[model samples]
Target chain A: MRAIVLASRPVGTPSRENFEMVEVDGEKEKLRAGQVRLRPRWFSVDPYMRGRMNDVPSYIPPFRVGEPITSEAIAEVIESTTEGLSTGDLVRAHLAWQEESVLDARFATKISSDPGMSPTYYLGAMGMPGLTAYVGLFTVGHLREGDVVFISGAAGAVGSIAGQIAKTQGNFVIGSAGSDTKIDELKQLGFDAVFNYKKSAPKDALRSLAPNGIDLYFDNVGGDHLEAAIGSLRNFGRVSLCGAISQYNSTGPTPGPRNFEGNVIRKRLEVRGFIVSDHQDERVAFERDMAGWISSGKVKVLETIYEGFSSLPDAFLGLFSGSNNGKMLVAL
Target chain B: MRAIVLASRPVGTPSRENFEMVEVDGEKEKLRAGQVRLRPRWFSVDPYMRGRMNDVPSYIPPFRVGEPITSEAIAEVIESTTEGLSTGDLVRAHLAWQEESVLDARFATKISSDPGMSPTYYLGAMGMPGLTAYVGLFTVGHLREGDVVFISGAAGAVGSIAGQIAKTQGNFVIGSAGSDTKIDELKQLGFDAVFNYKKSAPKDALRSLAPNGIDLYFDNVGGDHLEAAIGSLRNFGRVSLCGAISQYNSTGPTPGPRNFEGNVIRKRLEVRGFIVSDHQDERVAFERDMAGWISSGKVKVLETIYEGFSSLPDAFLGLFSGSNNGKMLVAL
Candidate 1:
C-alpha cells in the first residue's frame, strides 16, 4: 500500500518536497476481535491537514514526520471479522492519505450510500465540512431570517455550504472569495452579493455590499476580512469563527484584527471559536437538513476532484493557492 | 453652576488642557411639564468614558467640543415640577461632569439610599460598574463553582468587584494589577492571587500562578493581558470581554494578541464582548445579591475619591496613568 507521509515540516509554505509517498506493507499475520481490514476508495485532502504537519499543540495531535498522514476517507470493507460488518460495506474513518488501513471497527462509521449519488459526498458535503457549516450558521452564528451575513472564503468547503444554508433560510448573504471565478461561483451558490478580495480590499467591498451593516459574520479567513466585518457589524452582532486559512501556513505569528476588541466592546459582538468535532450533537439534524437541501436542489455541491492518488499533494497545496473552486478532494 | 466641557479632543492620552470649566445660569425661564432641576454630588470616572473623548462612532456618541461631557451621576433633585420627584430625592442620570442640569425628569433613575452605605455607592458599587462585574462573571463568563478565573485590570472598578465576586463564589481567582499597591489592595479584596503586570510579563505571571489552565477570563485590558488569557485558557474556555483600556486611547490601531485566533480555534475558546447597558434585566437581581454580599462582608467596595469639582479632569486622566486604584470618582 502507498501512503503519503510528511517528509519535513515546512517553514513558510509547503512544497512537494515536504510530502513523500512511500510503499507500506498492509498485510498482517493476525487480526484481533472487532478489527477490520479496509481498502480506501477516496482519499480526502483538507486544509486542516496542514496543521497536523507542524509539531504544535492543536485540537488534534501533530502528524509525526516520516509517518503516514491521515484524514477522513470512505473505504470499502475488503475483509471484516467485526459485528455488523460485511465484505462490501463502505465506511468512513480517519484513515485517508493511505491506500489501506487495518484498525478497530469502532472508530469507523458505515456510510449508507445515498441512492443515485456519489460516495465522495461522505468526504465533503455530507461529512465534516457540511456539519461544520450547519453548526457554525445555526449553533454558532445564530442564523436569523433577515440577518445580513458576510462569509469570508466563500468558495471553500465550509463557506460554500454556510452561505447556501444562510441564503435558503432567508438571510441576505454576502461573500468574499480569492478569485473572480470563485466570486461568480459564489453568486451562483445563492449569495446575494460576492466580492473578490484579491481584486479589491474586503473592507471596501463589505462597506458597499452590506450597506446596513452585517448582523452575523462567518469568519473563514480572519485577517482584514475580520477587520471589515468588525467595522461593518451592527449592535449585538455575532461572529462565528470557523478558520483563518490565510495564516495557517505562516512561518511566524500573524496579528489579529487591530480594531476587533474596540468594536467588540462598542457593538457587543459575540465572537466564538469552535471546532465541528466538539459539536457532534448536531450531526443528525445537519445531515437531515443538508440531505433535504441537496435533494430539493436548494443546496448544490461543487467539488474539485484530483483524478489520481499522485495528485493528493498538489490538491492539498492548492487550497492555500485558491486553485480549487469548492471542496478539494483526491480520487484514488 | 459650573460644568466641565470638552475644550478640544486629545491626540492620544487626555490632559487637563482638553477639559474646560464653564459657568452656567441655574435659573430656568419656566418649568415645563415634566422638567426637573438637579445638582449632581457624585459622578463616575470610568475607563469606558475614555472612548467618548474621541470623535468616533461607538456605543455612545463621542464628546463634542464645547459640549458638556457627561456620564452616570447621582444628583439631588433641586426643583421638580414633575410628579413623583421631590427636592430631596436622590437621582441617577446621564448627567455628570456638570454641577447642575435642567432636563426632562423621565431619563433619570431615582437612587434609593441604602440603610448604611453612602450615596456614592449608587455611583460605583451598586451602579454601572457593579452591574458590569456581575453580568460579566455569571451571565457572560458562565461562572462555575470550581472554575479557575483570571481577571485583567484587577485594581479598577469592574475588575476589583469581578475578582471578589468570583473568589466569594468559590472559584479560584487570579488577577493582574498595574501597581504593587493595587496588588496589595486586591489581596484585601479576597483575590486568591494577584500580580503586578508592570513588574513582569502577564503571560509569565499567569503561567506561574495558574498551573492549571484558566477556565474563565474576564478581560478588562486588551493587548498583552488578552494575549496572556488566550494562552492560558483551557479547552472550551470562556472570555467575558468587558474592556480593553490598554488600547482605548491609542491614536492609531494596535495589533491584537498575535496568536489569539489560533489559540481561540485550537482550544475552542468562546470570547464574548458585552456592554452592561444592554443588560438592564439583571439590575434588580444584581442589587439584591450585591447588597447581601456587602452586608456579609463577602464583597468589599473600594474607591479613590478626588475632592472638589476642579479635580474631575485630573481624576479622569489619572485612570489612564494607573495613578488611582479602585473606582475613581469625584465628590463635589
Candidate 2:
C-alpha cells in the first residue's frame, strides 16, 4: 500500500512537495465481524481540505504530520467480514487518499451505479457537494422564489451546483468566478448574471447586477467577497456562509469590513455560518431530490477530474488557487 | 413653542454647550382635517438619538443641524380635529426635544389610563425599549431557555430589560455596565452576573463570568464589547445587534475586529443586525406580553427621569456619557 503524508505545514499556499508519497506495508489485522477491506476507486480532493492541513483551531481539528489524509471516495470491497457487503461490491467510503484501506462496514454505504451514468457522479452531483449546495442554499440561505442570489466562487465545486440549484428554484441567480472563462461557464449554466471577480471588484459587479439588492448571498469564498455581499444586501437579507476559501491559505490577518456593524444594523441581516454536515438529517430527502434533478436533466454535474491518485496533492492545492472548475476529483 | 436643538455635533461626547434652547411663536395653520396638537409628557432620550444627531448614514437618517430632533415619546393629545382621538387623551407619538408640537393624528396611539401605570412606563418598559428588548432577544436571537446571555449596556433601557427577559425565560444572564452603581443595580435586578465595563476590560469580565461561552449576546455598546462577545461566543451562538452606543459619538474612525472572520467561521455563529422598527408587526404581541410582565411584576422597569422639557438636551446627551440608568426620560 502507498499513501501520501504531509511533509510540512506550508506558510501560505500549499504545494505538491508539501506532500510526500511513501510506500507502506498493507495490514489485514483481525477484522471485527462487521469490518471490510476497501480498494480505492475514485476519491475527492476539495477546497475544505486546506483547512484540515493548517494546525490552527477551526470547526474541525487539523491533520497531524505523518497521518493518512482522509477524504470521501467511491471504493470497491475486496474482502468483507460483513453480512451485506461482499467481494467486488461498490461502496462510498471516507477511506480515501490511498491505494487501498480497510474500513468498518458501518462507514461504507453500498451504492448502486446506473449504466448510463458514471459512479463518479455520486461523489459530486449526488454526493457531498450536491447536498452542500442543497442544504446551504435552501436550508441555511432560506431561499425564496424571485429572490436575487449572489453566489461566490460560482465556477467551482459547491458554488457551481449551488448556482444551478438556485436557478432551478426560480431565483434570480448572480455568480462571481475567478476568470472570464469560468464566468462564461456560469452564464451558460443559466446564471442570470456572472462576473470575473479577478477582473472586476465584487462590490461593483454586485451593485450593477443586483441594483435592488441581494436578498440571499451564498458565500463560498469569504473575506472581501463576504464584505462585498454584506454591502449589497437589502434589508432583512440572508447570508449563508458555506466556506472561506479566499482566506484559507493566508497566514496574515483576514481584513474585515469597514462598515461591518453598520451593514448588520442597516439591513437587519442574518449572517449564518454553516457546514453541509450539519444537515445530515436531511440527506434522505436531499439524495432523492438531487437524484431526480440529475436523472431528469434539470441539474448538470461538472467534474474537473485529475488523472491519477498520485496527483491528489496537486488537485487539492488547485482548489485554493482557483485552478479547477466544478468538482475537483482524483481518479485512482 | 420651545425646543432644544443641536447647535453643533460633538467631537467625542456631547455636552450641554452643543445644544441651545430656542423659542418660536405658535403660529401654525389650523388643522385642516386630520391633525392634532401633542403636549409631550414623557420623551425618550435614548443612545439611538445620538446616532441621529450626527451627520452620518445610518439605518435612520441623521438629524439636520438646525432642525428639531424627533424620536419616540409619549404625548398627551391636547387638541385634535381627528376622529378616534380626542382632546386630553394620552397617546404614544414621535415628538421629542420640544415642549409642544402639532403632528398628524395618525402618528399617535391613544393610551388608556385605566391600567393605572404611569405614562412614563409606556416610554420605557411598555414602549419602544421593551419592544426593542423583546423583538431583539426572542424574535431575532431566538433565545432558548438555559442559554447563557451576555448583555452590554446592561443598566440602560434595552439592555436592563433584555437581561431581565432572558432571566425570566430561564437563561443565565451576564451583564456589563459603565459604573459600580450600575453594576450594583444589575445585581439588584437579578442579573446572574454583572461587571463594570468602565473599570474592567469587557472581554476579561465576560470570560470570567461566562467561561464556557455565551449563547445569546444582546449588543448595545459595540466596539470592544462586540469584539469581546465574539471571543466569548460558543458554537452556534446568536448575536442580536440592538445598538452600538460606543461608536455613536466616536469622532475617530471606528476600529475593525482583527479576528472577526475567524470568529464567524470557528463558532458557526449567527450574527443578526437588528433595528426595532422592522419588527413593527410584533408590537401588538410585544405590548401585550410586556404589559403583562410589568403588571405581574415578572419584569422590572427602572427609569432615570430628568425633569422639565428644558433638560431634554442634557438628558439625551447623558445616554452616551453613561449618566443614565435604565430608561432615560424627560418630563415636561
Candidate 3:
C-alpha cells in the first residue's frame, strides 16, 4: 500500500519537496481485538493540515515527519475484530493518508448507509467541514435573521456552506472569493453579493456591497480580509475566526488588523476564535440541520477532487493558491 | 461661572492649546421642569475620552469642538425643579466641564447617603470604572478560580479593580504597568506578580512571570501589551478589551498584535472589546458586590485627583502620558 508522508517542515510556503510518497506493508500487522482494517475511499486535504506540518504548540499536535499525515477520511472496513463486526461498512474517522490502514473501531464512526447520498459528502458538507460551517455560523458568529453577513473564502468548503446557511435564514449575505468563477458560483448559491477579492480589495468591496455595514463576519482567509472585516463591521458586530489560510504559510509573524482598537473597542465588537472539533457537542444538531438543508436544496455541496491517492500533496498544496473551489479531496 | 471648551481638534496628542477657559453666566438659564441645577464637584478623565476628541463613529458621540466636553462627574444639586426632591443631594451624571450647568434630573443618579463613603468614590471605585472592572473580569473574561490572570495598565482604575477582584477568587494575578511606582503599587494591591512594562518588554515579562501561560487577560493598554497577552495566553484563554491607552493618541493607525492568527485561532481564544456604558444592566449587582468588596477591604479604592476645575484638560492629557497612578480626576 502507498501513503504520503511529511518529508520535511517547510520554511515558508510549502512545496512538493516537503511531501514524499512511501510504500507501506499493509498486511504486516494483524488486526487486534478492538481494531479494524480500513481501505480509505476518500482522503481530505485541508488548509489546517499546513499548521500540523509546523513544530508548534496548538490544539492538535504537529504532524510527525517521516510518518503518514493524518486527516479526516472516509474508508471501507475490509475486516473487523470489534463487537460491531462490520465488513464493507463505510466509516469516517481521522486516518492517515494511505490506501490501506488499520484503525481502532471506537475511533471510527459508521457513515450513513443511505444509498441515495454520496459517501463523499461525509468528507465535505455532511462531515467536519459541514459541522465547521454550521457551528461557526450559528454558535460562534451568532447569525441572526436580517443580519448583513460577510464571508471570506466564500467558495471554499466552510465558507460556502456558511453563506448558504445564512441565506436560508434570510440574511443579507456578501462573499469575497479569489476567482471570478468562485464569485459567480457564490452568486448562484444565492449570496446577496459576491466580489473577486483578487481584483477588488475586500475593504472597498464591502463598503459598496454592504453599504450600511456587516453585522457578522465569517472569517476564513485572514490578514487583509480580517482587517477589512473589522473595519466594515457595524457596532456590536461579531467575527467568527474559523481559519486563516492567508497567513498559514507566512515565514514570519504577520501584522494583524490595524483598526482593532478603533473599531473593535469603539464598536464593542466580539471577535471569537474557534476550532470545529472543540464544538463536537453540536454534532447531533449539526448533522440533522445540515442533512435537511442539503436534501431540501437549500445548500449546494461542492468539491474539488483529485483522481488518485498520489495527488494528495498536490491537492493540499492547491489550497494555498486557491486552486480548489470548495472542499479539496483525493480519491483512491 | 467658568467652563473649559475644546479650542481645537488634536492632530496627534492633545495639548493645552486644544482647550480654552471661558466665562459664562451661571444664572443665564433657569432650571426648567424635570431639570436640576448642578454644581460639579469632581470630573473624570478617562482614556476613552480621546476617541471622542476625533470625529469618528463610536458608542458615544464625539465632543463638538468649541463646546464644553462632557464626562462622568459627581455634582451637587443646589437647585432642583424636578419632582425627585434633590436639594443638597450629590448625584452622579455625565456632565460638562463647567462650574455650573443645568441638566435633566433623569440623567443623574443620587449618590449614596452613607457618611463614611467619600463623594470622589462615586467618580472612581463606586462608579463606572468599578463596574467596568467587574464586568470585564466576570462577565466578559469568564474568570475561573485557580486560573492565571494577566492585567495590563494594572495600576490604572479598571485594571487595579480587575486584578483585586480576580485575586478574591484565588486566581494568580499578574500585572504590567508603565512605571516602578505603579509596579510597587500593584504589588501592594496584592497582585501575584508585577512588572514595569517600561523597564521590560511585556512579552518577556509575562514569559518569566507566568511560565505556564495565563488563562485570562484584562487588556486596558492595547498594542504591544495586547500582542504580549495574546502570545502568553493558554488554550481557551479570554481577553477583556477595556481600553487601548497606548494607541489612543497615535496619529496613524497603530499596528495590532502580530500573532493574532497563530495564537488566537490555534488557542481558540476569545477577544471581546467593550465600553462600560454598554453593561449598565449589571449596575445593581455591580453596586452591591463592589460596595461589599470595598467595605470588607477585599477591594481597595485608589484615585489621582488634580486640584481645581481648571486642571480638567491637563488631567485628561495626563492619561496618555501615564501621569496618574489610578483614576484621573479633577476636583472643583
Candidate 4:
C-alpha cells in the first residue's frame, strides 16, 4: 500500500516537498464482519482540504504531520462483509489519499456510473463540492427565485457549482473570475454576467453589471470581495459567507468594509456565516435534487484534472493562484 | 405658537445655540373637520434625531436646516374641530417641536393615565423605545433564556429596558456604561454584571466578566464596543445592531475588529441590523408584552428629564457625551 503524507506544516503556501509519497508492504489486514476494503480510484483536492492541512481551529480538525490526508474519494471495493455491499462494487467512501483503504462498510456507498457519465463524476458533481454549493446557496443563503446573486471566485470549484444552482433557481446570477478564460466559461454556463476581478475592481465591475444591486451574495473568496458585495447589496439583502480564500494566506489585518455599520443599518441586512457540516440533515435532500438535475442535463460539472495522487499539494496550492477552473481532482 | 427650529447644522456636536426659538400668535385657520390644535406636553430627544440633522442617508429622511424638528410627543388638545378629539383631551401624536400643532384627529391616540403610572412612562417603556428593544431582541437577536447577553450603552433608554427584559427571561445580562455610577446603576437594575467601558477596555472587561463567552450582543455603540463584542462571541452567537452612537461624531475611518472574517466563520454567527419600523406587524405583540411586564413589575422604566422644551438641542447633543441616565426627554 502507498500513501502521500505531510512532512511538515508550511509557513505560507504549501509546496510539493512538504509531502512524501511512501510505499510499505504489510500483512493483508482481514475485513471485519461489517467492514469493506477499497482501492482508491479518484481523490478530491478542495480548498477546504487546505484548511485541514494547517493547525487551525476550523469547522474540522487539521491533519497531523506524518499522517495520511483523507477526503471524499471514489473507490472500488475489493472485499466487503456487509449485507448491502458486495465485492467488485464501485463506491464513494470517506477514504484517505492512498491506493487502498480498509473501513466500515457503512461509510462506503455504491456509485452509479451511467452510460454517458464517467467514474470521476462521482468525486465531483455528485460529491462534496456539489453538496457544498447546494447547502450554502439554498439552506444558508435562503435563495429565492428572481433574486440577484453574486458569486465570488466563480471560476473555482464550489463557486462554479453555486452559481449554476442560483441560476437554476431562476436567479439573476453574476460571477467573478480571475481570468478572461474563466469569465467566458462562466458566461457559457448561463451566468447573466461575468467579470474578471483580477482585471477590474470588484466594486466597480459589479456596480456596472448589477445596476440594480445584488440581493444575495455567495462569498467564496472573502476580504475585498466581501466588502464589495456588502457595498453592492440592496436593501434587505442576504450574504452567505462560505469561505475566505483571499484572506487565508495573509498574515496582516484584512480591513473589512468601511461602511459596514451604515450599510447594515440602512439596508437592514442579514449576514450569516456557515459551513456545510452544519446542514447534515439536508444532505439527503441535496443528493436527491442534485441527482435529478444531473440526469435532466439541468446541471453541469467541470473538472480540472491533475494526474497522480503525489501531485495533491500542487492541486491544493493551485486553488489560491486560480490555476484550476473547476473542482480540482487528482486521479490515482 | 412657538417652535424650536434648526438655525444651522452644527460642525461637530450640536448645541442650544444651533436652535432658534421663535414665537408667533395666530388662530387655528380653517382647520379640517377631523383636525385638532394641540399643545405639546413632552417631546422625545432621540439619538436617531442626530442622523436626521445631517444630510446623510439613513432609514429616514434627514432633517433640513432652518426647518422645525419633528418627533413623537404627548400633548393636550387646546382647540378641536374634530369628531373624535375634544378640548382638554390628553393624547399622543407624531408632531413637530412647536408649542402648538394642527394635526388630524386620527393621528392622536387618547390616553387615560393610571393612578400608579406617570404620563412620561408612555414615552419611555410603552412607546417607541419599548418597541425598539422588543423587536430588536426577539425578532432580530432571537434571544433565548440561559444565554449570556451583553449590551452596550446599558444605562441609556433602550439599553436599560433591554437589560431588564433579558434578565426576566432568565439570561445572565452584562452591560457597559460610561461612568462607574452608571455601571453601579445597571447592577442595581439586575444586570448580572456591569462595566464602565469609558474607563475599562471593552474587550478586556468582557473577557473578565464573561469568560465563557456571550451568546447575544445588543450593540448600540458601534466602534470599539462592536469590535469587542465580535471578539467575545460564542459559537452560534447572534448580534443585533440597533444603533452606532460611537460613530456619530466620527469624521475619519472607523477602526474596528481586525479579524472579522475569522470571528464570523469560527462562531457560525448571525449578525443582523434592523429598524423597528420594518417590523410594524409585531407592534401588537410588543405592546401586549410590555404592558404586562410593566403592570406585573417584571420590568422597570427610567428616564432623564430635562425641564424645558428650549433645552432640546442640549438634550439631543448630550446623548453623544453620555450625559443622560436613561431616555432623554424635554418637558414643556
lDDT-superior candidate, 2 or 3: 3
- TM-score winner: 3
Q: Give lDDT per model, in order.
A: 0.87, 0.85, 0.89, 0.84
Which docking band does candidate 2 fall into? medium
Q: Where does candidate 4 stray beyond 4 Å? A: B10-12, B15-18, B24-28
Candidate 1 chain A: worst-modelled 10 consecutive residues by lDDT = A24-33
Tens-digit lDDT track of model 1 for A1-332: 78889899988789999999998886763668888888887877788888988898678899889998788888888888898778899998888477778879998899887874578887778999999999999998888889999999989988998999998899999999998899889988889999999888988898789878999999888888888888899988999988988888887778778877888878888988889998998999888898888888899898898888788899989999998877888777
- What's the TM-score of each model vs. the native? 0.96, 0.93, 0.97, 0.96
For all candidates, state DockQ relative to the true structure: 0.76, 0.57, 0.80, 0.63
DockQ comparison, 1 vs 2, better candidate: 1
Give candidate 2's whole-model lDDT.
Answer: 0.85
Error of 3 at A46 (Å): 1.2
Residue B227, candidate 1: Cα error in Å is: 1.4
The DockQ ranking, best first, is 3, 1, 4, 2
| Model 2 lDDT per residue over A290-313, tens place | 877777777787888888878888
How good is the docking of model 3, as DockQ? 0.80
| Model 2: fraction of the reference interface contacts it also forms | 0.56
Candidate 1 per-residue lDDT, tens place, B1-332, comes to 78889999998888999999998776755768898888888778888888888888677789899988888788889999999898999898888577778879898888877776778877777888999999999999899989999999988999888998898789999999998889999998889988999998988998999987899999999998888888899998999999998997888888878867778878888888999988999999999988888888888889899999889899999999997777888888
| lDDT agreement of model 4 with the native | 0.84
User: Model 4 chain B, poorest ten-residue lDDT window?
Assistant: B248-257
Q: Kindly report which residue pairs in candidate 2 clash with one another.
A: none
For model 2, what is the error of residue A70's alpha carbon versus the real structure, in angstroms, after optimal superposition?
Answer: 0.6
Error of 2 at A29 (Å): 3.9
Better of 1 and 3 by lDDT: 3
